[model samples]
Target: MLPCRNRTGKMRLGASIESRPAEVETRKTFGHWEIDTVIGKKKGKNAVVLTLVERNTDFYITRKIPAKAASAVNSEIKQLFSDFGKKPEKIFMTLTADRGLEFASLAELENESTKIYFAHPYSSYEREINERHNRILRRFIPKGTDINKISEEELERIEDLINGLPRKRLGYKTPEELFNEQLDLIYRL
Candidate 1:
């Protein structure tokens, strides 16, 4: 794809990953997240999977978006605002995304409570959380499998199964468990 540019043709990107807080790298805090899109066909307007993995607890979210377009992702983000409910800021403290044109609008979501960061071009390692989970996700939906063909319910089921699995990384605790604990604390405050 050609570079995403403005009317004046200036390529647009958000705050550099370098600007991200040092604490984010340590993964000791809740709410920091890594986001990405998983696409099937390289050719069609098929649906894509929007994946987000919480840096701290490994809580994963998968939403089947209409397409790999800015509008679709933005709409989904708006939908998440309602899903996150009364205080989205507590759950969505910071978002680290790639320099995809579709994510060009994500910077607009930044405020006092939420910030957006972009990894350097070609640097997928910076967002390893999304990468590893996407590999796990690939077990259910292989590469090149048309994401649009998977029903929303099935996708959600796959997510639930993965999130329900216990992990050695968290001392055998499932991601959902730790995630719920964080939610309890956030909502309890």
Candidate 2:
């Protein structure tokens, strides 16, 4: 796989993950997210899940997408941005993603309030939160299982289960609790 930056030092993808603000790395603030895709099968461009986990609270969001193409990913992302139905821009400060073709169109979404950063090819560690949560998600949607068979209700149940679990690293607080609290604060502002 080609690195995000080429020999000429030009970024073939979007901006480097290193260029993301310091607060994002430290998870000192909210709204920073790490995103990735979970495919059911690679045989065809069937269905997939677009997962986004907040860097700070580990609040994960999943969307059942039609395919792993740029259009599907971008559409779901835009839908997520509008989930709040108002002042949606304030909810997505930045997003860190891998150098996949599905993410190629993400650079177009970058603006004043929302920034998009691409991790170096083959470097999954940069999106650790997303990777870890994906592992947990695999418990429900195992590899080789056609995700298209999984109904949206089942996916939401799995997502809720994960978000409701208390984590020691999070001071024993559930991600859902913290996520809702933070989201409330954002909407209030």
Candidate 3:
């Protein structure tokens, strides 16, 4: 593919941009999330999988979207954070996403104190934790399946099962334990 540029004519490296400081700045808790969407089915279809990864604990939250556009992603993310609570504090700090137009309307998704940051395009590896969780999810929900039929409850159960699994990085502890401990530490501050 040819290089795509921003309005300035400077080369925009699709998803190859790096913004590690922004990620570091916003991750205030174990639950601070990195967000991405996977396109399923045929091209230009209305199916999407929203993936969120907790920075510190490596726990993930996956929600299936009926549409794959930016507006659809923004709204779904807003609803997901709202489910955490109406308050902005529970919404965690930073959300790192790729430069896809699906997240083009990120500003609209921002609540009072929540900040949004974009990672470089095609750099899903930068968000490796989420990528790993994506693999785990594929065991239950394969790629290219019509994601719209998966209910919210089933998605939650999948999230639960993934979180319940022990991780060697955490010395065989579950994400639940690591996440809770990190939250407790944050609360103590």
Off by over 4 Å in 1: 1-10
lDDT of 3 by residue, 1-189 (tens): 989666685434222225444445444444467777765676566567899888777777787877878778878877876675444364466677777678778755555566666666567776677777888888988877667777789889988999999988778999888877765665565
How high is the CA lDDT of each candidate model? 0.92, 0.89, 0.71
* lDDT score, candidate 3: 0.71
Cα lDDT tens digits, model 2, 68-168, are: 98899999888887777787666689999999888989888888889999999899999998999999999999999998898999999999999999999
Candidate 1 clashes: the total is 0
Q: Which stretches of candidate 2 lie over 4 Å from their true place?
A: 1-11
Residue 126's lDDT within candidate 3 is: 68
Candidate 1, residues 104-135: lDDT per residue as tens digits? 89988788999999998899999998999999
lDDT of 3 at 62: 80
Better of 1 and 3 by TM-score: 1
Q: Which 10-residue window in model 3 sums to the lowest lDDT?
A: 11-20
Candidate number of the best lDDT: 1
Candidate 3, residue 176: the lDDT equals: 80
